[model samples]
Target: MKLYYHPLSGHSHRARLFLNLIGAQHELVEVDLMAGAHKKPEFLALNPFGQVPVLDDNGTVVTDSNAILVYVAKKLKLTDWLPDDPVASAAVQKWLSVAAGQIAYGPAAARLITVFGAGFKPEEVITRAHAVLAVIEAQLSGGSFMVAASPTVADVALYSYIARAPEGNVDLQAYPNVRAWLARIEALPGFVEFRKTPVGLAA
Candidate 1:
C-alpha cells in the first residue's frame, strides 16, 4: 500500500495513524504541498480534488480521509473499529459527521488560518471550536471512547484536529473530559501523532 500525503495535514495524519494502528504494511509518498504538487496532473488523476492522503492499495484507490478509514476498517476486517450493531454503527457515523462538519469548520478551520494562511476569521472559528468542544466534553464525561468502550473509527476521525486544537489558539484546558479522551487515545498501542506547528497558544 502507498499513501500520498503531507506530514502537516491532519487529514493525512488521520489516515496514516489508522494504517499504523492496524499494523498495515505501507509506504509513505510525501506530496509536496509547498510546491503545489498536489494540484498537478499526476496527483489530480488520483483525486481530482487534489488532496493529500489518497491511499493506493495495489490498483485500488481511496480518496478522502474518512472514506479511507471506512475502507481500511472493512478491508482489514477490524470489526471493532466499525461495529455491526445498527445503533452502535449509527453512533459511530454521528461522530464521523461531527469530524467532517463542526470539527472541520471549527478547530480544523482555525488551524488552517494559522498554519496555512487560510482566509478565515480567527474569532469566528475559535468560537465554533469551543462550541463543538463543549458538546464533546459532555459526551465524553462518562466514556473512555467516543462510541463504544474501545477505540473506533469515530475516535480516529475526530482525534487529529481536536488533539491539535491548541495550534489554532483553541485551548483544551477547560475541557477536562476531552483532554482525558485525547490522552487515552495517545496511550493506545501504535498511536501516532500529527506533526506539531510552532504557532498559536499551544506553541
Candidate 2:
C-alpha cells in the first residue's frame, strides 16, 4: 500500500496518524502540491477530487481521511478505540464528522488560507475556526478524549490540525481542555508527527 500525501495537509495527517497508531506498514509517497502535481492527470486518476491523502492499498484507492480511519480502525481496533456500544459508536462517528466538517473547514482550512494562499476571507476563517476550538474545549472538558473515555479514530482524525492550530493563528488561551486532550494524543506510542510546517508559520 502506498499513501499519497502532502506533508502540510490536515486530511492527509489524519490518515497518516491512524496508520501510525495501528502500526500498519505501508509505503509513504509524498505528493508535491505546490508544483500542481495533484492536478496532473496521473494523480487525478488516483483521486478525482485532486486532494491529498489518497491511500492505494494495492489496487483499492481510498480517498478521504475519515473514510481511511474507518477502514483501518475496523480492521485493528478490537475495542481499543472504537467501542462496541451503538450510541458510543455514534458518538465516535460524530467526532469523525467534526473532524471532516468543522475541523477541516475551520482551523485546518483557515490555516491553509492564511499560510498557503487559499484566499478565503481571513477574518471569517479565523472566527469560524475559533468557534470550533470553543466547542471542542467544552466537549473535552468532560473526558480525556473526544466522544469516548479512551482514544479512538476521533482523536487520530482530529489530532494534527488541532495540535498545529496555534501555528494557524487561532487562539487557544481559553481552550485548556482541548489542549490537554492534544497532549494526551501526542504522548501515545507510534504517533507520527505531520511533516511540514503549517502555511503562515513558515519562516
Give a tens-digit lDDT track for model 1, residues 125-153: 99999999999999998799998899999
lDDT of 2 by residue, 97-178 (tens): 9888888788887777766878778688778889988888888878898877779888888888887776677777678898
TM-score of 2: 0.93
Off by over 4 Å in 1: none
Top of the candidates by TM-score = 1
Error of 1 at 81 (Å): 0.5
